[model samples]
Target: MNSFFHDENVALYRKLIAENESNPSRDEDRHAMLLTLLAEETAKAKQLPRLPDAW
Candidate 1:
């Protein structure tokens, strides 16, 4: 997968989490699910190859 997509997904997950927390009637289950997904996605993103500064 492309790093760009991974970054986008991470950003989206963060946004969703924020929204869920602020919601008056948020589902705990959904919040947990989103947090889990965000952690997994962040791990995957970190595993992606990094380009050298010269690049």
Candidate 2:
């Protein structure tokens, strides 16, 4: 289970994605949303307990 994602956030992203899918104009919206989600995941990962193995 992903602790970082809440109900509200999921709903909001779903709405955004649905909107972009319904209308194929202005391709930046999907890219921007994806980047935002990635950044959010990075932020959440930073808060986790550190381990020996790393990049």
What clash pairs does model 1 have? none
Cα-based TM-score, every candidate: 0.87, 0.46
Q: What is the C-alpha RMSD of each candidate to the true structure, in Å?
A: 1.8, 7.4
lDDT of each: 0.94, 0.61
List where candidate 2 sits over 4 angstroms from the true fold.
Answer: 1-26
Evaluated against the true structure, the overall lDDT of model 2 is: 0.61
| Tens-digit per-residue lDDT, 10-55, candidate 2 | 5566677667667757488565876587567666756766545554
Spell out the clash pairs found in candidate 2: none
Error of model 1, residue 46, in angstroms: 0.4
